[model samples]
Target: MKRPVPRIDLFDVRPDDERAFVFAQDLRIIEARLFSSAEPQTSTTLRPHLSAKADVGALMEALQRDYAPRGVNLLRVAGGWMLCTAPDLAPVLNEQAPEQRKLSRAAVEVLAIIAYHQPVTRAEIEDIRGVSTSKGTLDVLLETGWIRLRGRRRTPGRPVTYGTTPAFLVQFGLDSVQDLPGLDELKGAGLLDGRIPAGFSIPLPSDDPQLHEDEEPVEPEPLDFTLSPLPTADEDEN
Candidate 1:
């Protein structure tokens, strides 16, 4: 008879060092899942595949550390984590994507006001901008899916309030509306005048999806807008 083959139970005879190796293997699996996913993965969605003792936070931290210096980085977006190219690579990647149309100056101003002071009404936006807002301006923003009607204010006339959408956050690369640059940051970027106004401050923006106590749900309304004819060459000349 052949010499009895030495029987070794890998699981039963595993060394203490193997525990760390197994933990690392688990991290690799998590990393692969996140890397391969098209959308961000939440901890709850990723936990089932992990052992009971596996710490999701620690695994995510490890993956973040590993990719920190790489072109791709793990980012938290909309309450979940996803892999994204580093900010430094934006210019290069932007060239690969289609040319994005820029918002008009008026639209930009209206959007900024709405973002910073949301649950704001058309009248409020006009007041802040010191001019009357054309219905077409709001229509353009609504069509773009950036701003949305929040609810009607509980005051007189009960005008519809507007707020920024998640699409706005994503378009601006913001994780939340709270991440908007503060007044000081705006001044540093030369976006705000450095005038010395005592107690001047920026309002904190909230992304709360629910209607506030002062707001009422919007009621379905028939569209009342009509398009005007484009200006002809003769009209343009005049």
Candidate 2:
């Protein structure tokens, strides 16, 4: 009888096939890393486990393409990569999930102001809103992990400034603050009516993650405690 043919393994493949095989394994590792992570993973974090010849960018692109037709998609958010449910499937999933607590209208307005004009003080927020911001509203936002105390304003009293956090970007599916809708886009969405106001313009937000000239780094330990709680006109407003 003729000798049985030997089994073909990935190691026995041609040069191109061998690289492809290695890449497939790398893709598996990437998928696992993404699935197991509670937060988005950056290329810097994912590069270590990959093969020496594997290109993280190329692998990510390939993986993105592979998932394009599936229920999940590879998205770049908060300066990193994550696999998330396809946008079209969100409604169905939302229905299945338990009802989630929603931000109050006042909280929503405060969040929007911070997102657009970050490194802003409570007074500045009140200035923009034309009303005293309630402490409860800020407390609620802080408890949600959507915003953080960035730094202290250089002006007298050195009030603590607030800005949106990375969680904010992840929740909103934005790659960066700059991805926020522009004035025209907002108007087109009917968010901004055709109200006539001369010299009206929306400020372009930044994601510098650095203290501004008018701001100072938040000191740790006892210094942080020295800043008293912000004065609120209302004890509670939801």
Candidate 3:
């Protein structure tokens, strides 16, 4: 004899019609988890409490709405969500503790070069700067979480190319690399001389985060090679 088929009620309502109540309870659970944790939580980390059909995006939206006017606001940071102080409160908070540890001139220059001419190799940076760049300068930018190794050039020796990170866009208040100051803006800001050669221009920067036609995918930096000094301008000439 054939076994009877089990019936599954996809829309079955629970007692007291408590589905909405259950969602609200789940929202509270998520809120408590976020509040108690010191670090930002990703959806994957918070999914255990939610049913398979639960909409994590909707829950996050609701939480964001609820916290919009509060002292703490939900913010997307470094590709994850975190609760952060309101922008209006920043000035008051900053007054209590001033910023220290400014970037050195070399570090600043290196950062600027990487931001503007990204996916650039060390040799390209040196060529633009008219001086040799120190590995320490690159290290400082890396430590700041502003720039990252993108890939290696397809040319000889496959030197690693560098590019600005998403953190760089967040820190600089830029929506995209294309929003970087152009020649006209630079001239207006007095960063560049008003009098310049005809057809002088800044190349439009790309933030595509993909290896270009001339680039090979990045390989892991060798453990022993990372500490070694990068080639200087003189070394490049030789």
Candidate 4:
């Protein structure tokens, strides 16, 4: 008779150890998903890639714990999960300036106004800024993917309205538009004067993508907005 194969019990493993191994595998899957994605990943989007019985929440928590001491961290951003370098490491990494188109001051102001007051018309933006807003400025912002044409206002001209995009939230590392600095925080940051009118206040920003009661959906083939070439660095307005 052939030498009896060495008897081995495959089921002799401890239940806790087996569970731990499964947990570690699931954590790796979650980690890989986060690493491979260019944008933040929501649990719903990540569920299909994991084992049927995997607990995504627990796995994410465990992965977060594992990375707590690392140079990078798993953080929530733009209503999803993303791996970001720890804040403390920013100074060390700031020397390498990434090449990117710089936004003009006008574009920055327009962007801020859109973030604070969404579904606003071009006229409304100009009114709030107390100056004319150039189509070129709006075009620069649109090209940045930070703002979008939300809809058309129901008023006389039925002008197109603007709102912040999810890209804006991600760029700013915010979970929502409401996470933007409030009046108190602005004052603390010296972005506002200490002496302000009692009635002056910041508008509560909303990123809701729905058309408001006074707004209508944009046409399927909306009219193309005419955009002028962006100004060169030296020509950009202060």
For each candidate, give its TM-score against the true structure: 0.75, 0.84, 0.63, 0.82
Q: Local error of candidate 3 at 194, Å?
A: 6.6
Q: Mind giving the per-residue lDDT tens digits that candidate 3 earns over 101-193?
A: 899988898888888888899999999889999998899889998899899999999999999987786675455688789888898899998
Tens digits of per-residue lDDT for model 4, 1-238: 5332222232354456766556566666777888998898988988887777777767766667777899999988888889988888999888895868889888898999999989788999999899999999999899889999999998887899999998998888898999999999999999899788789998999988878999998887656897789989889755
- Candidate 3 Cα misplacement greater than 4 A, ranges: 1-17, 36-45, 95-99, 128-131, 165-210, 217-238
The best candidate by TM-score is: 2
Better of 1 and 2 by lDDT: 2
lDDT of each: 0.83, 0.87, 0.78, 0.84
- Candidate 4 positional error at 82, Å: 0.8
Model 1 regions more than 4 Å off? 1-33, 36-39, 48-50, 196-198, 222-238
- Tell me which of candidates 1 and 4 scores higher on lDDT: 4
Which lDDT tens digits does candidate 2 get at residues 1-238? 7333222343455656766678777888999999999798998898889998777877777778778999999999999999999999998898788887999999999999999999899999999999999989999999999999999999999899999999999999999999999899999999998993788878898758899999998886465446768767685552
Clashes of each: 0, 0, 0, 0
lDDT by residue (tens digit), candidate 1, 1-238: 5332232333354446665655676676787888788756878888888877777777777777778999999887756688889999988888799877878899999999999999899999999889999999999999998999999999999999999987787666677899999998999999988684798889999979999999999998868997899999999999
Candidate 4, poorest ten consecutive residues by summed lDDT:
2-11
Task: Please provide the root mean square deviation of candidate 2 (C-alpha atoms, Å).
Answer: 11.5
Distance (Å) between predicted and true CA of 35, model 1?
3.8
lDDT for model 2, please. Answer: 0.87
